[model samples]
Target: MKETPIIAAGLHDTRSLAQRIRGQALRMVTRAKASHIGSALSIADIVAVLYGRALRVSPAAPRHPERDRFILSKGHACVAIYAALAETGFIDGSLLETYGADGSMLMAHISHKVPGAEFSTGALGHGLPFGTGKAMAAKLRGESWRTVVLTSDGEWGEGSNWEAALFAAHHGLDNLVCIIDYNKLQSLKSVDETLRLEPLHSKFEAFGWAVREVDGHDHEALTKLLEGSPWEAGKPMMLIAHTIKGKGVSFMENKVEWHYRNPTPELLDAALAEIEGACGNA
Candidate 1:
């Protein structure tokens, strides 16, 4: 893997990159016979916006001391991260072919073994806590680096995330940013049918965090929201991004069954074709 340096300051069209990410993710899942295609598809645009514009990271120096930190709290949707890393040049694109193969660093779950991955997370409710610690450390050291944790809305039911939220709010960790993929679908069922998190807006307010809601698939909106972060100067930021499960592919959109379904060869072709058209228009 010949890693190349990335110029963090340059801007790119993330909307276009999002299509590529989704395409790569679909292919990865289908090839590996892995699951979570819906989960990965849901966050494609959000990840695109971050890697395309908001995040300050370097592909060559994966451990760039001053780079921004991103944690995929919703790690089941890791194919998106893998795609983003390859898209952003953090790792060789060819390495993605090893996904889900035995002995490959690209395990079924997100792994810290990957070059740009900050933490290995599969169990629910772990990413936020680990990210909180990283954010706290940055604050104590007076570092300018920001810690962004991308979590699934379903994970909100976990007590650990709430505790981490409390810690982030109390300490005034303005550098901490959490983006929840509120796709409204959990693994086996819909979030509403499982653990309802209605009035989600007010809940964050009550927790002492600055909150905002946006369309998770809107790359422009995501970029704008991220650029104007620390929404309140003294609190952490919570962006409740409303997204659709199995977004993009017509057959998969909003279908809960897609949570664990891998695309067959025919389905993969259709998905990739849809993404290809989207990329052209993007």
Candidate 2:
């Protein structure tokens, strides 16, 4: 394993951390010629906030019994969380170089084998159900820890997600929180073209969840909302984070092609430069 510089910063540095996540994911996808760079970019800030301030987890004690659980339902965007894990010390940054290579734990999709990843979820609709079960278990065990599941806007098409929503509400699982990365783009087209999820907030409300919407890139708002989950007692929290696809990279923003398009070598250089310039060389 090759040793690389790690950014071992505290909570206050989440903005910089988000930039690093984007830069890291960009490079990883570029190296492997993998897909879903856009998906990963869309949720970079959200993931950064989760690891930086919201999650009650420790890299040194990744499997601590009392730690909060976070599941990424949009597992195709694994690079973002992988980057977060590396940056925050849950795993060595060097392992990132092996990403998408043969037999690496860092699969294209998120996997539980990776440190700090609570669940392995590549199939669209499984994350919420699994996370809901975990939340229910916590409630039954009288544990104070919370369960957070981040799903893609496009994933709302999965009937299983709705089933999990109803189950969570029926059980009054306030400790459960679900965040949607509403980037409005899916694998090959706009989410509206693929499947309309309008009145998304109202849909969650009907399912008995406490709903809130925010700009996904706003670090302050994201941290505040995520850290202060379960906005209402006896209700699951549904936060719809409206975000732009392919965020941070000038050429890729909101362009659906990026969903399956890996950045070319020249594009990778430009993307890294933009990300590093935005966050600085520090």
Candidate 3:
């Protein structure tokens, strides 16, 4: 499939970009017989908006010191990040064909070995801490680059994230922005059943971070809030992005089984057709 076009200043049509991300991610997961397509789909729009418009990154310079850092804390959904990197020209899109296969740099989890990937993260609760440290480093250097961490809501159960939250707040790392994929589902069931994270917004606010919530699938809404980060001067930003697991497919949406199931060939075909139709109309 031909990739979407990115214009000057890294600005692109985010809606189209999002559609492509969804479609590409679906294809990747299916081709690789991988799990977490649900997880990947949920954050497709958020990742699309970041790479297409919000992030200050360049295909020509994947490790540009001044480039904005984007960490996928929920690294199990590596297909989404891989699709984004390929679409944005950070890696040869062809390499995505090797995902989940032996000898491939693209593993089941997000890896820093990938050109645009900053940190390898499969273990939950690690990305946020690394991101906080990156933000602090930039602050000490008086650099303007920002760190954006996209975390799964279920990872909140890990106490380490709370500690990182407190640290970011105490130091006033305003450049640190964490967007939670509050899809309300985890491995076997809903987050409420697994571990309650209600009043999640209030919890972040109490941690001394500026907090906001938005529909994660809404490309325009995500772009508006993400492009205008650090809404407060002295506080880090936490965006609660309400999302649907398996967002683009009818059978998979809100279905827990998809967390570990790859789509059948028929389901893959149907899903791709649906995504293509949606993007064509959009």
- For model 1, how does the per-residue alpha-carbon lDDT over 8-126 read when each residue is reduced to its tens digit? 74377887788889999998999999999999999999999998899888887889877888999888999999999998888899999999998999987899999999999999899
**Cα-based RMSD of the predictions, in order?**
2.5, 4.4, 4.0
Clashing pairs in 1: none
Go through the candidates in order and give each one's C-alpha lDDT: 0.90, 0.91, 0.90
Model 2's number of clashes is: 0
Arrange candidates, best lDDT first.
2, 1, 3
Give TM-scores for every candidate, taking all chains together and pairing residue i with residue i.
0.96, 0.95, 0.96
Cα lDDT tens digits for candidate 3, 1-282: 754333223778877777778877887888888899999999999999999989988888787777899999999988888988998889998998899899999999999999989999999999999999999999999998899999999999999999999999999999999999999999988999999999898999999999999999988888888885589998999999999999988889999999989988899889988888877887
Can you give the lDDT of residue 62 in candidate 1? 82
Off by over 4 Å in 1: 1-10
Off by over 4 Å in 3: 1-9
Candidate with best lDDT: 2
Model 2, runs deviating above 4 Å: 1-12
lDDT digits (tens) for residues 63-98 of candidate 2: 777788999999999999999999998999999988
**Model 3: what TM-score?**
0.96
Residue 70 CA error for candidate 3 (Å)? 0.7
In candidate 3, what residue range of length 10 has the lowest lDDT sum? 1-10
